[model samples]
Target: MRATIKDIAKRVGVSSSLVSLYLNNRPLAARIAESTKRKIDAAVKELNYAPSATARALRKGKSKTLGLVVADLCSDYSSFFAQTLLDECSRYGYQLLIGITHYDPEEEKRVLANLIARQTDGIFYALRLFPADFLKSLNLQNYPILQLSSAAPEFQSMELAREEALKQCAGKLYEYGCRKVVVAHESWANILEKELEAYGIKIVGGRYATTSDDFPYLNDTPPDAVASDSSIYARLLRARCRELGIPMPYLCYSYSLPSDFIDDPRVIAVTVSDYKTRLSGIVSRMIRMLENPKEPVAHLKEPVRLMSLDELREYRCAQLKDPYYEPFRIRIKYEGN
Candidate 1:
């Protein structure tokens, strides 16, 4: 039979309530005599007593479980963020329940409902392509919901510094001598076209839905470089380049490239957001909100930087050659218009 609180209490010559309070680390338990505390600890060790998490949660009215929903599990960015969030959750004495929506609205709704049904105390939502009003309509009731990347006035969020990251990426690309560049996403292309034009770089905008083989308007005129808002698009561009037997142009990706492509020399530059820092901040904020739900919603932003080809290569080399080398110290200038 498993050792229980009553077992420890009986061995320590104390009340079960006292044992419970001490085991839970309640404030009142601190006032107990050191000798008595030592006796309780010794008794617990002798009996190999373990507290029941489920009973404690039931009494406290908290599940101690956090639900995390990501836009796409297949993407390296999402996977890395999810792992970081998991580690953060474990540090705060919470278990993580993860759900992947693959960017589908119906799947997202289903996952959210399922997580709630499983009695998750809070949720961390990280959707890339969600509609602006989608989260507002959700009836989260008393549960705290924190968003990553997506934003709304009703919930706390950690938003990406996309425009700044883009400017940095453009600067790095220009430094690489990319005079004409094709931006894969229309939305970002629209925002960045004039910005790049001001830097004397011609810009060609393409839709996000374009495929590697069927990219429009590229047959006659291939740009000197291809830039994408996502790693997926970057991969597609690489595939297209490989299929045509043409040298892959100087490529710049706004998001971290997938691990397979990270070392590819053709990928001239990338914009890397500090996801670890952002996720840690969000986790800390969420824990505080759980402790006091009435706390005002926080809007946090993390810094992003562009990594040039030379810097990336140097980092990769350091990883292979020097065990003590720190890659974050390498610096590059941002000169976008």
Candidate 2:
């Protein structure tokens, strides 16, 4: 049987109320003598006493639970974000409940309704779709919402610093002597075409097929380098290069590269937005809002960095050897000497 506050109090020859006060760090606890406090601590250690979270929630009339909604839990980006938020919530004495929407707007609505029904203190949305109309219709006065990767004027958000990251990437490509570059996604190509034009590096091809079957055209005309917003497109580019019996060109990735690409020396560089730091800030801000409902809503932007694949490989290898190893500090590379 689990030990209770009464059991620890009895063992320490103190009253249950006194034990409760000390455990909860109440104002009265400060008045207790040092020796008495030490005795109570020793008794708690001996009994292996743990406070009941459910009981405390009932007394306080607040459920210490956080709801996290993701587009897809299977994706590496979502998985990493979810795990980081889960750890942060656990540290703050809150439990996390996850909901996966698979990029469906209706499913997202259902998930949000369920979380609200369950009385989650706050909701963290990491979904792909940002339906402004739906968000505006919801009554969010009671439960605060925070978004990642996307933005909505209705709630607080931690958005990716995309423009700066693109500038850094274009600078790196220019420094590497890339005269012509092929960008994979049309949306990013449109943005980057303009960004790289100033550097005199022409965009040879703005759109390319991501699948193996539609990539034969790359064999006939290969550019100096390839840039992509998605790691999926980057992977396809490398695969197409291999299939054509041609050397892979210098590759620049916008987001986190796939795990398979980390060890492949063909991938020269990648741009990564610091998700851990961004999520930490989000969780802290959400907790503050939950504690004080009158707190002003704010927006946050996470900085992105350009790093070499070789450096990432070394860092990942070291981390794999030691489970307690801290995340490797990113060394940002610039264009000029």
Candidate 3:
């Protein structure tokens, strides 16, 4: 059985009230001699007692746990972000409890409510779609609520400048001499689409609403080169491209992508240093803000590029300049020795 103050008091022949006062560092009865304090300390050591977590929490309001919720756990990016956040929570002397909402409004509400009931000190929410009532229900007036990737207002956010991220991808794609570039994805913000179009790159992929037949961009057979929203889709596309005889295409990816995907002969991915070092830049900054709300915090944003098969062979060391866009290279690799 775990030792408690009562055990110590019983062994020392003193009231538990006196033991509590000494343990809490409260001023003892003025007449209580220092000898009494020494005796209590000796009894505590002999009893080998450790305070309960419930007792510690009752004393300090915080349980030293942070709750994190993500829209979906299936995405590669979400998995990467969760690991990063977990590591950051450990660094801050806090435990992390994660929940997946799968972008469901009802699920998010239920998960968050459970976390609150458990007294999580703070919350980190990463959702693709923000339900209308989510913010209304959250009593964040006193708590520090952080949005890891989204820019919702109810919570402070850690975001990469969306335009800048897209621009980096576009500029690099242009570098590899892609005469005919077809950019496709499930869906992206209208503002981002316009920016990609401005680069003279064709936005071939249909929007989330477009049916396969309407646009037929990439044609399910895959294009010469492709950049996807996630690495899983990228590899799926790569395999499909091989089956269709579409030459191994140069690809652009995010930091969330793994190295194994890039190492394939048919794929040469841009390696962003952020993936290896300080991958938790977002979570780390969020935790720092929680530690010091008034210290003038800033978002952590950096870029990393991956090169695919065609890029690796064509521009292994090729340096070129572009007048219209950033002087970048679409690094690539070759497939089928």
The local distance difference test score of each candidate is 0.72, 0.73, 0.58
Better of 1 and 2 by lDDT: 2
Better of 2 and 3 by TM-score: 3
Q: Give the per-residue lDDT of model 1 (tens digit) for 1-337.
A: 9999898888888899998888889999989899989999999888888878867796789989999988676655576567767888999999999988876789988898798788888888876434546544556645688877566666777776667767766777788888888877664676567668878988764434355446654576777888776777777777777787877778777643224235568787777754445667889888988999987777777777777666755544444343222222222112110
Query: Any idea what lDDT model 1 has?
Result: 0.72
TM-score of each: 0.69, 0.68, 0.68
Q: Single out the weakest 10-residue window by summed lDDT for candidate 2.
A: 328-337
lDDT of 2 at 23: 92
Q: Per-residue lDDT of 30-108 in model 3, one digit per residue for the tens?
A: 4467898789889878878887875687468778888888777665456656776777678878888888887677898
Of 2 and 3, which scores higher on lDDT? Answer: 2
Query: What TM-score does candidate 2 reach?
Result: 0.68
Worst 10 residues of 3 by lDDT: 323-332
Which digits, one per residue and each the tens of the lDDT, describe model 2 over residues 8-122? 8888888999989999999989999899899998988888888888778857877899999887877556666777789999999999999988777889898988888887888
Model 2 spans > 4 angstroms off = 1-61, 177-180, 185-193, 202-220, 254-261, 274-276, 313-337
Candidate 3 structure, TM-score to reference: 0.68
- Candidate 2 residue pairs in backbone clash: none
Q: Which candidate is the best by lDDT?
A: 2
